[model samples]
Structures are given as structure tokens and as C-alpha cells.
Target chain A: MIGTAQKIAIEKTKTSKITSVDFDNLPFGSVFSDHMLVCDYRNGAWEAPKIMPYQPISLDPSAKIFHYGQSVFEGMKAYRDKDHNIWLFRPEDNYKRLNVSSKRMAMPELPKEYFMEGLKTLLQLDRDWIPQSEGSSLYVRPFIFASGRGFHASPADEYKFIIATAPSGAYFSSGKVKVLIEETYSRAANGGVGFAKAGGNYAGQFYPTQLAVEKGYQQVIWTDDNAHEYIEEAGAMNIFVRIKDTLVTGPVSDRILDGITRKSILEIAREEGIPAEVRKLKVNEVVEAAKNGTLKEMFGAGTAAVVSPIAAFGYRGSDYDLPQLEKSYASRFKKRITDIQYNRSEDSFGWRFKV
Target chain B: MIGTAQKIAIEKTKTSKITSVDFDNLPFGSVFSDHMLVCDYRNGAWEAPKIMPYQPISLDPSAKIFHYGQSVFEGMKAYRDKDHNIWLFRPEDNYKRLNVSSKRMAMPELPKEYFMEGLKTLLQLDRDWIPQSEGSSLYVRPFIFASGRGFHASPADEYKFIIATAPSGAYFSSGKVKVLIEETYSRAANGGVGFAKAGGNYAGQFYPTQLAVEKGYQQVIWTDDNAHEYIEEAGAMNIFVRIKDTLVTGPVSDRILDGITRKSILEIAREEGIPAEVRKLKVNEVVEAAKNGTLKEMFGAGTAAVVSPIAAFGYRGSDYDLPQLEKSYASRFKKRITDIQYNRSEDSFGWRFKV
Candidate 1:
């Protein structure tokens, strides 16, 4: 907030804690950014907002975010168009969802102006960091944490909102992905923070996902909280079911997330004369249909992948491969979403915002 | 782990960020000990185990814990007895549960030995920081986070486990407290992280809990996720209902925390020949029982409060107060639990572990 456009002062502190990480040709999330945006909340207002060269933040070791896990975040990208203009796809959605996530986590709700302005500041200063390769973008991570120094079970009075960017390539280096229908583990619960993009929800998926990974799958498709009989979502992304000509997804509730990409895809489906259903997709029905070949395609929708086609879904010790389509919605939707995101197409939906 | 039983210099770094402070009159979670236990996971094993003076942990702003909520935590206390002895009650249970939570969040499993060994190292060095107040103890918080420093919808390849302690006094200066029944917002869903001690679980309750605080209530009694019709646990504690000669409470599942104190109380109730039933507790039943004079008493049980008697419950926009009894279970059971905790009574259940 101190910088009208993001400005940062570099600081270097050597830490011999871990081995030196390789910084060249990094995979997604395997590299680093040298600077980050930070702002503090104290005396009931945000103060001393600034970006500093990425360095370790000294904490009491009893900070609530570490122990209580009182943290939430947003995932977006800063795209470098051919003309070198930085573009954010539906950034207002991320800013709005971040506040919703903060309220659910009992952390401070960031001002919309502050969040938007903060992104503008960080993106402008870190323009060199945004990679230019196809499927490449500067992954923008804006997060808020309960930084109150303590080991107690309560809302944090003081907080720090920080923004960091990482240059991430495609979500999957592979062309297709295989996932598991999560019959046992769940990402979130009904009446919980499922609707809010809170960090704990993703952490909950790690263990079950590791199991899925061992079983040779890429992701777990979570079911409903009550019975696990209803299909819900795939990890942090919202899911879509393609049955013949109709596209279906779970309704937003206390269980599923209201993803920014999910919403945009629905609008695109409407624009293309495709019928989209936002309702519960029961597991039994889908499984039975998969056996009979009505399940034409399955894919996940989120800001990260845009659209990731499911190669297969493992369920009840059985594996099933989805039917292939020549003009598949997965590829179509992905291209449509990305075209608007990267400014390769007209912004008919007005989703893209200039940074 | 490298240290002998004799006191030695582990690691030293006084925080200059905090200039001055009174450690004695500290608010719960408002202060921290100097040294903290830290362990890292690298190359498929936990390595670099050390107890160092508390300091800032540098992270890429795009760390996965911030965006996707990949974090979980555990809360337990190290108590000091009259002999200046330190003890951990059900620490193994906490460590095991922490792994259960970590696995659910896609984090690495922290070794039980590391958990025990880490606490021993940190507490031994920071023993002077543990207060000696009547209801005071060194509150220990152990947590694991996704240390993979960037954003994508996948598990972290690296992790950091830490333990920090805080000196605290009584939660409520007055022994008694009041609670409200939240008939709208639920704490967790049937197949959610309610059972796990995940950080996101605590964050989800902040909004509704804040509403309760604004209305002059201490906490919200969360109901079942689906209907919000049946009573469940407190946001951070478990609820116990005493109606007539029968004691009824919600059954444990994926949706509710298997509270340590709640189980201990059930064991005590069984020992005392009291009829204790762990089943779905409906709000209407409690209201009707209170109307029929069958509702003897109600209270919450957890490590934080031990046993907190509910003076009144606001449900369905109506408040109900119960008549106080001479032999409230809160007093007797709290005494029974704390007596064993402070080494003043028999450890019949073998719950306490001496360090």
C-alpha cells in the first residue's frame, strides 16, 4: 500500500538452514521469487504496507498462522501479452474470494481497494519475472495470515497480508491426467469453509491424495460431506460432468467452492448453445452411467488449469477410462478460457482486467 | 536430540523486534518462549532436527500453505508440578492425531519420536518461560505446513514441523461461562475435517463465533452440518448434556473432534455409574428437557477449559437458563481431570506421561 505502484527494497540474509535450492528451469512451485508484498494490520487499520525483497519473517515461533493454521490465500496469474501488457483474468473475483476466505478463517478481511492496488504494485515491479513462454505466467499468490504472536485458540488481533509471485508453467507436464473418486476422504465439510477458499481445506486433501498418488492417480475427486455418495469437486478445482450433450456440475453450497473459472466456463457453455446444469452429480448414477458409456467426458475447472481433462477415475478398486471426443469441451473450454485470459481473443465476458 | 539430559545451550537468538515485555502478566497466546523446536523433511525423511531460538521463517509469498490452506496443528500443554517436574498428558494421542490431520492435509507424517524428542528439547531449554500460576501451564502448539514455496493444486514436496510454547493463566477469571446454540451456521460437516485438528477447521468458526461474541456469548454450540438441527461440539471443544439421570452427547465421526477431555469424562461417568449415551443430541430435546425440568446441567469439555458449565444457552433466538446444582459435574469432573494433571490425585486412567 505504501507504493502507488508496487515498489520493493531488496534485503539479503543468509540462512544455512537447508541446502541451496536450484533456481534454473524450475518446475511449478519448485523455484522462488526474490521479493514479496507485505502489509500489517494493527490498531484496527492497515499500516506500513510495503514490498521487500523476499526474506524470512521473524515470528515468535508461536505465531497463530503456524499453529492454529489460521491462514487463507488466492491463486491468479499475471500474463505477459505479446505487446508486454500485464493482464489479470477476473482479478476482482480473486480479491472478493480472498475476503470471503478471510472472514471464514477469522482473519482480517482485506479491503478490495488495497488488494487490487497491492496486486498492481507487485505486478508492475515484478514484470521481469513473468515468463513469456506459452502456458507460462507469473503465478500471483496473495495471502493473509493470523500473525498474532501466541499459542491460543482465538481470533488474531493483528495480521499481515503478503503477496508473492512465482513463474509457473503448465499445471501438468503430461497431456492428460488420471484421478480418483474420493470415497473415503473429503476436502471440506458441509457448513464448513468449503465455500471459502481457505488453506486448511487443501491441506486436508494431501494425505488422501498421497494415497491416490500411490494408486497411480493425479488427483482425488471429493464427494459430498454427508454420505460421500454425491460427487463434489476435484482437489482445489470445481468439477464438471459431461453426459452426452449436457454439462453438469455441483451447485455452490456449504460444500463446493464458487470457483472463478467455474463460473466463467458456465457462461461460455451458454454462449456456445450448450446446456449447463449446476446441481448434484451422484456417484452411483455416474458410476452406473460410466459402465453403460453415457459418461462421455470428465474434467476439472479452476484458475490454475482452466480445464484439465480426466483420463480416468479410480473407484472401489476398479478403474474406468473415459470416452474420447474429437471436439471435446475440455480442450474447447480450455482454449476459450485461456484465449480470453491471454488476450488472444476478444474479452466478450469482460473477465480480463489490466494490471 | 543431540543433547544430554543435563541443561545446555541449545540455540540462542533474542528477538529484537519485541523490545520490552512483562512475561508474568501475559495474556493467553500473547507471549512466546525464546527457543522453538524445528524439523524439516527432505529426501523422503525428516532431517535437520534442532531446537533454536525463535526467529523469522522466510518463505516465498506463493507458498502453498497460503493459497490452498495446506496446514494443520495440534494443541497440548506441558504442566509443571510442585516438584518442578514437567509432564505431557496424552501427547502421543496428540502427535498421532497431528499426523492423521497432516496426512489428511497432504503433509508429511512427523515421526512420533521427533514429536516427543522435539518437545523435550524445547521445553528443557525454555523451562524458565513456563509460568507457575494455578491454572497456568506451557501451552505447546505443534503444526506441519506445505513448505513447497509456490502455487499449484498439488501437495508440497517439502515440509517444516515446529513446536512453540506460551505461558498462560486461566481462560476465564470466573470459573463459569455461558454458550449459545448456533442453529444456522454449523462448525463442520459429516465427512469434513471436524474430526481432525486442522487449522482450517478453527478458521471456519470465526465468523459465526464472532457473531456470538458480539451478542455477549462466549462460544457457539455448533450443530450437525446437513440440517443444523442436532447439537455437536463447540468450535474448539466438545459439548456434554445432562438430562435427568441420563447423559447424552453427540457421537464422534468424521464431522466432530474426538476430544481428549470428552472421552475422559465419559470414562469418569461410567466409573461413577452414571448413564452416559454418546448419540445425536437434538436442540429441541434439550429445550424440551429443560422445559420438563429434566435438563439437570450442560457444559463443554476440552483441554482449554477442562469443564466449562453453561449458565445459559441462546437457541432459536430464545435464551434458556438452567438451575444450578450443588454437585455440578463440571466442578467434580474438572477437579477429577485437573487433579491427575497436576499430580495431586491418582492416575487411575494412566493418562499422564512423565518427561
Candidate 2:
């Protein structure tokens, strides 16, 4: 059990213990690490944050966060090297992206120093949890919520910023995944909070994703809400498609998340002398390309699953099975990206952050 | 500080010894009452809820609620009658509205017992904060959050249900407020989380609301995202327009919140035999109605202020002032609503819930 210490005060607790989280095989979000970092905003200033043992918090049911959904979040990972030194892959991007999310959600912008220092301080203490096995890392989640009384439709006077870590393996146990192109539901809309990593945006997709799972698909690839023509993203990850020799993906807009891995993969593709293009990839064009055997490969890119190759696509109850190729682009992209992440190759893009 | 001992064991804390919050000088959510109610969604079942003294909670900052906005909340108030008895007006409506919000946002649906039992328990302990002052009541905020670990784009396995109270004064101290009609910015989209009380939906409006405030308006009335032509809700409140004595409000959709106060106002309008139309209210049509002297009164309705009459509107740098009338329709509606709320008048529609 963690000590009952307040993060803002830096006041030490009578007892500080190394708590243990039951790390038996888990099904995501079930287990947690020992210590968590928290910072509170009140009186027009952000207080000093602290790391204490993980425990349940007491909140007035009336706090603005739970009801009004004034919350935003970021996703990044801490990789464990062969030498037992902890490394973070592209953490600055996560910090910058978090602020971008904060701006879109109208939450206060958390300083990059605060994000870096908080995660560093917190992860340094929980470094044992970063698995060294391939496709394993310490997933770090940083989020902020409005914490105040009553339910007026305005900003909360108080905010709580907390960080938690989870030991996670690769997103998929299988080599490839199947996606269902969503026709009815959308992850986000134009001029909406789609690009932001706000909690509500994720919650909005659960039912549709569940429907996809029920229909024997791994995830649903969302499209633009206004027209449902332009491909947006797949579940939480950004997607890439290879038509003939050229790679095509959707452009980043208010409706699409600007994925860090998506950006990295694009950079890698160019460095490898592969044709990578970011533009409006219409659904019909991709479907036609797949039918004509021009679409050689399709995959999702995100921090969790560096490159998840899509083996098939289900649309309007019609299944389109992708042909297996001796040399696939997804395998190449995944290997190149993961190598840089684990520091197995030269760090040309300066993506690795050593802890 | 409230004892963490009572927080864990479901034992009621002794709040009688705690210093009470001054109800008279309450500045919105700054002050809280002595007790709070909470329930947990664990082991796939909601446990029996409890009410204890209000206190701080410990949580991993990376919990899904903070980052992804996997949070939903509702705002309602417990009214004090002239006879010193406490009453709740159609809390079932708020519960239903909260569920609607939950389904849309992909959070777990709170049980009716957690919604009702939690509120009753908290209000019973903190009834002292239910101000007897006119237009004042103990504001109740019931919310649910994603308490699970990690930042993956999936539904949370664990959740918390809480109810907190704050004593608030009248929504507006002086006369009717002026609002700016936002032609560009949007609150929610057809496939967005706007209809739900999701936090990100409100966060997305903060910047636009600030712009409206800078334009010398209290709130920015939203329009549809695609065309910015159809009128939606106000900043944190559902809006109403009176056209030639007919109370008009927008039809609730993916773009608008299903407010408890909005539903009640509709009931009151019907009971009084006043013509009330619920449909798509276009901004241009509203402007024409105001120019033709048919727009009688514009008001914003929610649990906090109940109903605030809007005196004028600013659109594209043009100002339109609603005529001032004696025994204004807004005053009549607010009085009738408050009368039934405070038990001063008969609740002909059986809207009042005795606690």
C-alpha cells in the first residue's frame, strides 16, 4: 500500500513502502504500478507535484471532471535497454502533443518541463516494471482533469494532473489484424475535439469498436463525419496504405490525430526510398485499389503498436482478404521503427530520450 | 481533514463536528458541504454506495478519466422549501440524461440506485447547505469516471460514482445577460460527444467562450459545425427562445445536451398552455424573428441558475436587443418553476421529488 501523502505539499508520509501490483497475465488497464505522480492547480498557480504510492482518491461526486468531461490525456512508452538502462522513445513529442490536446480541450497548457520532470521523476522510481522482452515496455499515461465543485458550464477552478504506468506487451498477439471500415460511427468530426487525446473521444468509440469485435474484426477504421469519404484513423491508431509501389495515408486535420508513430513511419519510408504520401485517401479509391491488386499492404501506426498490418477489411458486411506477400512493407516498417525505438540501430531522427 | 478511515470501510463519518460551509457568501464551487456519496463499479457489479464526509482521494494521474475524457457528469440541485424541508425535482430525468451521456461517451451506465441512493445519502447528511435564500439550493453533481490504468484507446474496466454538493446563489445577480451567436466555432458535431456531458466537449468550447466573453458577451450560442447555421446550446446551458409568446428550444441531437432544466421548462410551458415548439432553430430565422419583434425573450436554462433571460444577442458585429417587458415571460417562467421547486406552489406535473 502507498503512503497517504499529498503530492502538492511534498509532505512525507509516515510510511513509504514499495507496493506490489499483481502482474499476472492481464487484459489491459487491470494492473497498475506502485507510485503515481500528481499535481494540483489552484489559486492561479500549479503546485509542486509529488510521487506517492498508488491508492484510491476521495472525490466529491460533484467534481467537474467526472460529469462535464473536462479532461485530456497523452500516451508514451519507456523502453528498457539490454544494459538495464531505461530509455524513452520520443517523449518530447508526447509532451508537445499533450499541450496541443490541452489547447483543443480548453484545459491549461502543462509546461513541457513539468511533463518531462514529472514523468522522469515518476518513471525513475518505477523503472523495474519496464519489461526488457521484445514488444514490451512501460506504458506511461499522463492526463489532466478539471476538479471543482458544482456543475456550471465553465472551467473548473481546480485541476488535477496525474501520471500512471502499466507494463504492456505488443498491442496484437497475432502477426496481423483485420479492420472494419465504420459506416455509422465516427471517432471525431471537423471543428470538433477529434485530434485531441481527450478521454471522451475514446469513450465515444467503444460501442462501435465493440460492434466490430463482435463482427470478427479487430478494430474499426473511422472516416470523416461530414462526408464519410476521407479516411481518418483506425480505432486509436493512424493508418497507412500501400497502393502498388506508393504509400498513401490521410492528411492530419481537426478530425484526425497527428500520431507520432505515423510521422516516424513516414520519415522512415522516405529514408528507405519508398513512396510515402500523406493526402486525402478516399475509401472507394482504396477499396478499388485493393480489388485491382494495386494495394499491396495496409497497416496502422501508433505508439502502442508500432506498425499493425491489416490482413483484411470488412465493409458493409463484405470481407476483403489481403493476399500474403513474400516481401511486405508492414514487416519492414515495423522492424525499422522498433529498431530505432529499442536503440538497436543508429538514432538518426533523435527520437530516443534516455532516462 | 476528513479521516481516510471512514473513506475505506463504508462507515459514515461524523460530520457534525466539522466546521460548516457558510451558505451566504458562497462563491460557486469554492466551498463544499460536510459529506459526499460514492459507489464503485468493481467485479462487474456496482457495490452498495455510501455517504461520508467530503475529502481528497488518491488516484493514478494516468487513469483513463483524466487523459481520454472517459468521464460523464450531471448537474442538479436539492431545493429547500419555505417549511425547511428538502426536495429534488425530477432527479430521474437527470439520471436518464446521464445514462444517455454514458452510452454516447462509451462509459459504463450508472445504476439507478447509485444515482438516487448516493444523492439521497449525501443530501441527507449535508442538508444544512441547502440555502433558504431565493434562487439558492444545494447543487448536486453526480459523475462517473474511468478509474482504470493505462492510456490505451479502450473502455475502462473500473469506475467510480460520486455525488458532491455546493451552495450557490442566483445564476445572475443583475438583469438579463447578452450572448454572442458563434457562427464558426462548434460545441459538438453530428458524430461528436457534444450531446453527452463529456468533459472534452466543454473543454473544446473554452477558447470560443473566451472569444465570446471578449466580445462583451457572457456566453457564445453555438451553431452546427458543418454550416454554422443551425443554433444549438449556449456555453454550458441549453438555450430557449420565445417567439410571439411561444417558447422555442432546439431538438436534442448528437449536437445538443439533453438538459434536465430544458425538459422541465418544456413541461412548465405545456402546463401553462403556452405554445412551446421543439425543433431545429436556425440562427438566421431567430435573427429575423428578433427583427420582426416576435422574439419575446431569450433565456438559458440549466441546474445551476435555473433560467437566465438573455436581453440581447450579437451576431457578426450586429447587436439586437430584446424588448424589455413588465412581468416578463422569463420572470413568469422562472417564478413558476422556482415556486414548484421550493414547494411554495403545487407541483401540478408531479415533478418534485421529496427527500
Candidate 3:
């Protein structure tokens, strides 16, 4: 409650575009909610947050964000429970992570009250845009970028923090996807800002991911920049491997993103009496396990997809198909999280927050 | 020549702001010329170029460039001759490199005719902004970025290409600077977009470079991401070392930017009968040379500074001072290039083009 005393300015749109949008055929981030939250930083302090109609922003051509990529963002979702109440899943975690990313990018940290209160207000105003369909929710995007017109290759003096919402269906239409183990390109290195949700971290992976896509894979399993032996993470997601009876994933480091979905799944797996391990998973070990039929399943964890099962993986010019299970850890964790998210089960963890 | 027949639409400003600009105390990129070149891309082709008044551009909050860093840019300069005629040095190279960067970032490639003709027309319209003082020129920045509001972690369908000019003095006011050898962080990796002038590449270095600056260093000498044994480039420039009359530099690779200034210096060094070698220079070899007094001089080569001599360098928590020479190769090369750039010497290589 940092800026609780500061009143937020509100401006409603003259007309609503919600009727034109087909909720049944909603895209992930194409259609936006009616309102957006915005706050500006200048002169050593943040301005009062405002909620206005979702619209385009006017920026100078020389804004540092466009030239230096000095921007950070967070991705979360608001689920519409069966009772018609809107809920945010661990939004405080997203607020904290956005500051972590902003610090790494040399941008200023936003106030907790500004971020939290603004988002709650925005979501309340656009409650009707929240999708009640199963596995669909209103995707929340909170981003901050350098907005001043200076080109000094340093942190900008001015910044803009914004929260925009979009009604999104399932991230991936396919139930399963194939991935490529990347060796030539590295996603991040030691002491780099890889752990931060910076825009460049995502941009740097597009070319390599495209190459993998051209080779019949939907995503790339990145490796350490120093050595290609150890598995890092998947494109925009954390990876998990199930070998026989144990679930293994790469431990979060300075070079690995600490995904919220990944953490939630690991917690649910442990609660369900499933053994889980967090250690460096070598590529060679995974390849060997795939060849010997010990690697039972692989999946990607992120906010968008929740849980994306990997059908096959390609390594060294060969593809290895993963075996499917009738009752697997991924499905179990996915169901548990979604059950809590949709308010179908008791809230044991106190993870959901009402807007 | 490609678009010589196509007319570029020009719009003049109602009133000039030239009188308000302080050319004598100009910051690097804070001030801009009156006019700018702009073009759009959609449906598989580029629109006709237009030169309009420099102003703010309206963009959607979810534009790909703001979230995914899908952008590329080029830096060059326009010089004013003594006869008041404007000239551009090797703009076609920048035009071609812009496309190279665009391809790597998955953005649409800009046409050569659009780039060249638009720049020529804009410069012609804003000719009064070019500074004629020594060590000062109009900095030309040509850039292309994703303009559509899509958050699919993919390339955008709409694109904007723009060229803007700013009157700038020297990038680094100090003639000599100290650099730190970075071993913990990496700038680029194998099969990465390091060679491309992508915005993410620059953003990734700010944190590490800030650490170096706090340690009393002006820049950082980056190393290979894989081994950290071979030298790559400086923060934004290419590193060149003179060892007992033989010049040595790291060869261009996927992890190093093909700097325009680096190439020009290499050509000038060879043409002047100074033997130059391009190979991987090991850190151990540089330390050994420094200890044995074989390293005569070290300098950074780039378009901004032209040639910035290195005063010292720190490695492994120890600083090594480079002995100042009476007549260093850095000074000699700097004089030759500046003389040609200022139109005081003959253009033997046809690098200069009149506007």
C-alpha cells in the first residue's frame, strides 16, 4: 500500500469495442480489454497512476527503448471463476519480478502500490472482458520501458509503466509439440541478465527458434552459453523432465528464469508425494535416457501454456519420441493448478487474489 | 540509383527551430534536425518514402519492438565541406548492413533505394543543421522496427523505417580511456546475432558495462562467450593492438560486429604499408606482451569515436598501464581518416559521396 493515498485518474472510452470481438475465437494478445493502467516516472518520483481507454501511445522517434532495448515486462493472467468472480494468480510475484527485471536493465523500480492498485482497478473496470470458458483467461501484461528521447546508450531519465489486458484462449492449440536441442546458439551466459524478463532475452531467441521451427520443431531447448552440455531452459518457458519415477529440472541460476508456473508445478508435485529434483540436467544424459527408454516425459512450464507436453525432441540430426503416460505428473499438476485457478477446489495455498 | 525515378514526398516545417539549438554545447543525441525520412512496410512490400517533420510517433502498447526487441539500427555521419556542400561517407555499406540485421532479427528488409534516396532528401532539407566545426558532424541514425501490436513471440507484419539526424560533438570527450577485460559476462555467442546491429545486443551489455564504469573503467573489452580466452570487441567498438610495428586485431566472426570504422582503419593501415594481421588474440598473449613490453599501443575503433586510444586495462583485479608513445599508430590513423572526412585530403578510395 505504498501509494494508497494517491488518487488514480480514470477516463472511460466513449464506446466499447468488446461487442465486436468474438470471445469464442479470441487470440492470445491481439484483442485488448477496454481500459489500461499507466504511470510515468520523472524528476525522481512516479506520477499518480491512471486508468484510461486502451489506445496507442505517442513516443519520440529517439526514445531509448527503441534504440537500446531498455525495457522489461511481466506476463500473468486473471481467471474467471465459476462464481463469476475475477481472480489473479500470484500477482504479487509478478510485481516483484518486474522490479527484478527493471533493476537488471538499469531502469527504475516502480512502486508496489502503483503496480498492484492500478492493476486491480483496471481489472475491475474490465471485468466483463474476462473469459469464463475453461482454460481461457484474461492475459495481463505489465511492462515498463525507457521513454525519453535521449540516445546516450545509458539508462533513460524518464520511464513509463503500463498494464494492459487481453482476453486470451489457450496459448497453444496443439496438445503436444516437438523441440530442438540447440547447441550452436546459446540463450544466456553467466553474469548476464538472462534471469530478467528483459525484451532482448526474448528477441535473441527468435532467430534460433525460427531455425528450429524450420526443422520441424516448435521450440528450442537452450543450453549454457559457455558449454552446450548442460540444459538451460526452453524458449520463453522452463523445462521439466520425468525419468522413470523422478521429476528433474534445471535449478534456477543467474542464467535461468525463475518462472512462476515452474515453481507452482514443483510445489504441487511435492505436495502430491511425487519426488522432484532441481539440478543441472546434462544434454548427454537426456539423450542417453531417451535412447534407452528411461526418459518418460518432457514438458514446458510458463504462464501462457501452463503445461506443454513435448511429443519428441531432436538432437544431433535424430529425433527421439517421448513416451506418453496415462496418469502423469504434468497432467496432475496442471489439473491441480487449474482447479484452484477456476475456484473448483479449496484454496490451500492461498495463491489466488480477488480483484 | 535503385529508386532514382521514384519521387520522395517532402513536407517542410512551418517554422525552423534552428535558433533555439546550442550547437556549441550540443549533447550527443539530444538535438535533432528539422526533417526525417519515413517509410512503411506491409503486405510483402515497402511503401514510397516520405520526408516529414521530426515528431513523435504513435504506437500500440503491445508493439513487437516494445515487448520482443524486434528492431535494428545503423549509425553513420554526414559531413559539411568547406564549400558548404554536404557529403556522406560509405552510406551504401550501412544500407546493406541494415538489411543484414533485418534478416537476422526476422524483420522486413528495407530497400536500398528507399534508404538512400530518403536520406539524401532529408539531409538536403535539413542542411543547416550540419555542424562544420572540427570533431563535429551530423549523426545519422537509420533504423527499422516492428510496428504491429502482436505478442506471439514472433515477427510483426507491419514495419517502420526511419532516418533522423542529430548534431553531435565527439562521443567520448576524453582522448584516452581505460577499459576492463570482461570475463564473467558475454556480448554475443556462436550462431547468435552479434554481427547484426540489433538493439538487444547493445541492451545486454549495459549492466556489465556499468559495473566496469563503477570500477573506474570507461569501456569493456568483451571476449568469446564459449572460452573467454579469445578477444572479441570493445563495448561498441572493435579493438586493435599495435605490437612492435605489427598491427593485430580479432577477425570478424558471428560474435563480433563488422564495424565500419574497423574496416576503414584496416584498409588505411595496409595502404600505408603498415602490416596488419587479423586473428584470434588470446588473453594470455596480451598479458605476456604487456609484461614483456612488446605491446606498443592499444586503441578502440568505431564510427562514433573514430579512434579512442586506450590508457590502461584491468584484468584479474590488476591494472596495466600502456606506455604512451611519442607518435602512436592510433593518432596517425585518426589524422588520416579525419582529414579525408573533413575534406582536407584526397579521397583515394572513393568513400565520400556528395549530397
Query: Which predicted model would earn the best DockQ?
Result: 3
User: Residues A175-211, candidate 2, lDDT per residue (tens digit)?
Assistant: 7699999877777766777788776677778878888
> Higher-DockQ candidate among 2 and 3?
3
Q: Which runs in model 2 stand beyond 4 Å of their true positions?
A: A1-36, A49-61, A118-127, A148-150, B1-12, B17-19, B60-62
Better of 1 and 3 by DockQ: 3
Over 4 Å off, model 3 = none
Report, for every candidate in turn, its global Cα lDDT versus the true structure: 0.77, 0.77, 0.87
Residue B62 local lDDT, model 2:
55
What TM-score do all the candidates reach, one by one? 0.91, 0.90, 0.97
Candidate 1 displacement at residue B186 in angstroms: 2.1
Instruction: Tell me the docking grade of candidate 3.
Output: medium
Quote model 2's iRMS: 2.6
lDDT of 3 by residue, B117-223 (tens): 88888888899999998889999999888887877777788889989889998888677799999998888867677888888788778878888999999998999
Q: After superposition, how far is residue B51 of candidate 3 from its true place, in Å?
A: 0.6
For candidate 3, what is the TM-score?
A: 0.97
What's model 2's TM-score? 0.90
